[model samples]
Target: MQDSESLQIARAMRRIPRWWLIPVVVLVVLAGLGAAYWAGTSTTAGTESTPPLAAVVPVSATVERRAVVKQVVLSGKVVAGAESVLQASHAEGVDRLVVTAVAKEAGSHVAPGDLLAVVSGRPLLILPAGVPLYRDITQGEAGPDVESLQTVLTSWGYACPVTGSFDLPTQQALGFWYKAAGFKAPTASDPISQGEAGSAAPKPSSSDIMFRWREFVQVPGDTGKVASIAGSGAILADDGVVARIRVADDAIVARADVVQAEQFAVGMRVTVRAGSTALDTTVAKVSSFLEGEHSENTIPGKDITVALPPGAQGFAAGQSVTVTAGSAATESLAVPLIAIRQEGGRPYLLVQANDQKNDQANGQPRRLEVKITAQADGWAAIADVDGLLVGDEVTLQ
Candidate 1:
């Protein structure tokens, strides 16, 4: 009955109502359905929203056993050592650079005082290398160093201000005297009034400085220490040729096993190589360790080393190079890299002094000073391990 009634109504409306009325009713019904669909989708909004995953951080182990060193250290540097400083009698002009020369490259040899390079100035010859120098006029005593220089200058007519002291004017006077005498200009070897000496002569312009250079031949050889003012201007050498002209660059020039002064020490860790075999070298010079310079970019490291290679082939004085020092030894304590601290200009190491409290049964925690034998990467060095017993409970700091 209801269906029949609805059908009748629909027919009646279709027959009586206008087209606009039916269209309006249908549009309103569609809007209502759309609103209901939106409400259903929006219900689970809280459960749908979730952020993305984040990154993870790695954790590192705080303790590990250090490796035991057993290999024979094939001690060697990648480059040759600095060439020896060509020392002359503090003379100003006799080819001041004669003693320097390209004796040989990384693997060559040469005699003493051989012609390495030509320098400007007179060659003075009173002292040999490694002589401690302090300036004084004693060599010419009553013959004051100043008056002697002034007399030489005045005679040459430079009218050097007689300061009664060997100052710049005096040096200039000396230079003038030398040039006027048709010899290379000279510098003082400490400004002493020497009795019978002046440079021989200067060569004509085109002549190489080598022509005016005084010759110094290599005798047998005593591995003696050589020293001079601390600068090797330009003039680099591999085998005697100035491969690099780095002027005014300072470098160290050391002879075999030589250090300045009477201070001698036993360096244990060193580099020793024989062709292909790398030997763990023994050091004898504690001072051999380089104390790097101070600067913004400086990584200061101390050298506890023995002397440079003894008779290492192809090394020269004043060669710029670096090396990996050998292992060092302390009396008996093998102090681990951890447990060492630096404070107030001293190094402190933790020792297992009390056996009762020690977990490792060596000893309990106590502080002791262990003579440093050598250091690498991260570890405390000791020459002997007697005092540091096995299983000594050294804390891993």
Candidate 2:
């Protein structure tokens, strides 16, 4: 009608057709994003399809260091204590021995029923050689100075054999008797000088030979680290102390007069002292030095003892040691035999925590479970010390 309503108002003012204003700009951007998510500004667009967050970077550790060989300067000294042999314990009557207790002296400390030298074996002289009107075990006989006192104790070696033969070791080396015509100390004093008895009888020197050979001691402790003192044992009974003083000040004891009798034998050579050191030991039997009824068949020197190379406790028993026998025993440590790493295949070495220690202990790493066991000479002994403790410090992987 007026040009068809002016051509539909000029096509609706000619601007709305960019796809029709895209549904009014998508409904005003969904109402301004729901009013900016209800005014809480910006934070609610999760539709749950995530699973894409990764950055990974952890697995490092270390600690394995052991190398203390101060150039390896080992050391060893403390010697002397080895010797054995002694015998005799019967054939009776030959003593005036009177000693009352002296038990184990001469670098002393004794065990095995201890108690040495208590004696009185004097009673020997059974005459009839010429019906000299004499009694037995000595209640008579001692004129002709008893064969000039058994030829001055068999010229002073007293194993006695002077042929004045009335036996009993010439009545136990008879020190001074013959109070015959009665009333003591009178070798017929008819001579403060029977004219020097034709002068000539002083020939027994080494102090007239007297050693009764009895020192036998040393056997107590010390097997601290390198053990092997064998089954060891000892037994005998005729106890005696003060084994030696020598030069006649007269303290040389054990059945008095320094033992002219008291013995035992059979492979004897027992001596095992530790500290300064002394081990020349071996034993099977020996015992009897004196103990009763006119006590002469004396026997007391054993209860059990034997040792052939097995003892260590640092040592102490008159302490004087120095021993090294047969020799052979080794087991040392200090490793590094190939970066070690095998797991179940075996060959392992784990202990690198100081951050894997590329910078060693500096990388601040960690790891553990070692066990190289043995490589020897080149040095290696790690035997699984994931727990370690011998100066702890290892690393080779």
Q: Residues 1-397, candidate 2: write the lDDT tens digits.
A: 9999999999888956558688989999999989988766444344445678787654322233443221111111222233221111222232322332332334333232233222221111111122222222231334453554456445545655655444555544432221121111112112121111122434222212211211112122210111111111122234321132211110101121113222212444434444454445443333343343344443332222233332345443333333221122244444555445576776654443432235455554334555554453445556535344444344554
Candidate 2 — worst ten consecutive residues by lDDT sum?
222-231
Measured by lDDT, the strongest candidate is 1
The residue-level lDDT of candidate 1 at 193 comes to 22
Taking every candidate in turn, the Cα RMSD to the unseen true structure, in Å, is 17.5, 21.9
Candidate 1 to truth, TM: 0.25
Point to the candidate with the largest TM-score.
1
Model 1 C-alpha lDDT per residue in residues 329-359, reported as the tens digit of each score: 3233445566665667566556544534544
Query: Where's the lowest-lDDT run of ten residues in candidate 1?
Result: 206-215
TM-score of 2: 0.21
Model 1 bad stretches (over 4 Å): 1-19, 22-26, 35-63, 67-307, 313-397
Query: Looking at candidate 2, what is the lDDT of residue 70?
Result: 15
For each candidate in turn, the TM-score is 0.25, 0.21
